[model samples]
Target: MKLFQYDNFPQVTGSRVSLRQILETDIKDLIEISFYDAIRAETVQQAAEMQSKINQDYLDGNSIHWGIVDNANHNIVGTCGYYRGLDKGEGELGCVLLSQYYGQGYMTEGMSLAIDFGLHTLGLKRIWAATGQQNGPAIKLLERLNFVKTADLNDDEIEYELQK
Candidate 1:
């Protein structure tokens, strides 16, 4: 599918948090969260750069990305987005959570909304996501959302997909 804006991104309310589109001011919060872990610095930097580009893309009509925020504190805890894939019916899903919010159910809640929005609102037939094989929490969350293992590229990463 073609990339688009998440201004219409699903406004899902869970027990503790909410999901909404990524905002321009969110860049600073993202910059802060991206620096939380030393070992992941290089990887985080690359991801941050990609996020900046995606933010611009969203602004320019290229894609949809959303910020996962805590409803109570109004703090951004993570991001999720759908990048256009090679096929009309396919799109890529991705997300990252702040270290402080790790182990919380936030990512799961956010990703569920993303997938639902992609399928129902965005008219995507297939949504896929990949994560480092060692990212146990992400893997578990994706699986919980009914994302099935579609490919195992290597020991380092696994590809998952959900078909509508």
Candidate 2:
């Protein structure tokens, strides 16, 4: 089935994590995750804005954003999305994880599922990710996923892409 065809976003499960739509109930968890995201949000208002934008973008036919849940405990650990907010017509991937869950390979596996869905389901030609220059783990994850350095988005941001 095509992504975003259901009332909720498509559920993509892996051995360690599952990707599904970030529900209203996930707001509390998202606030915690915001501490580790590029944009820091300490208040419910700020966090809710973040979550609202994600959902609103999807409803506007932008992209698929999923909450990364730890399969073992069913806890929301992070968020991941492909096409970089494009309408399934472009190729960019973005993700954020709780600081506590970092280095556990959850993002790697979760993003893999996203990339696979883009390739097999969306027929994307390539997928790219732009991350902060200081985000070593994110950079490493992109490299590990076989994404090549593409460009320098800014002094602090770098881009990488994986071609199909």
Clashing pairs in 1: 1-88
> Residues 46-89, candidate 2, lDDT per residue (tens digit)?
88887787676677666778889989999988988863535546
Regions more than 4 Å wrong, model 2 = 1-7, 35-39, 83-88
Model 2 lDDT, full chain set: 0.79
How many pairs collide in each candidate, listed in order? 1, 0
Q: Estimate each model's TM-score.
A: 0.76, 0.86
lDDT of 1 by residue, 29-61 (tens): 676444221223345455566566765666665
- For candidate 1, the clash count comes to 1
Q: Give each prediction's root-mean-square deviation over alpha carbons.
A: 4.4, 3.1
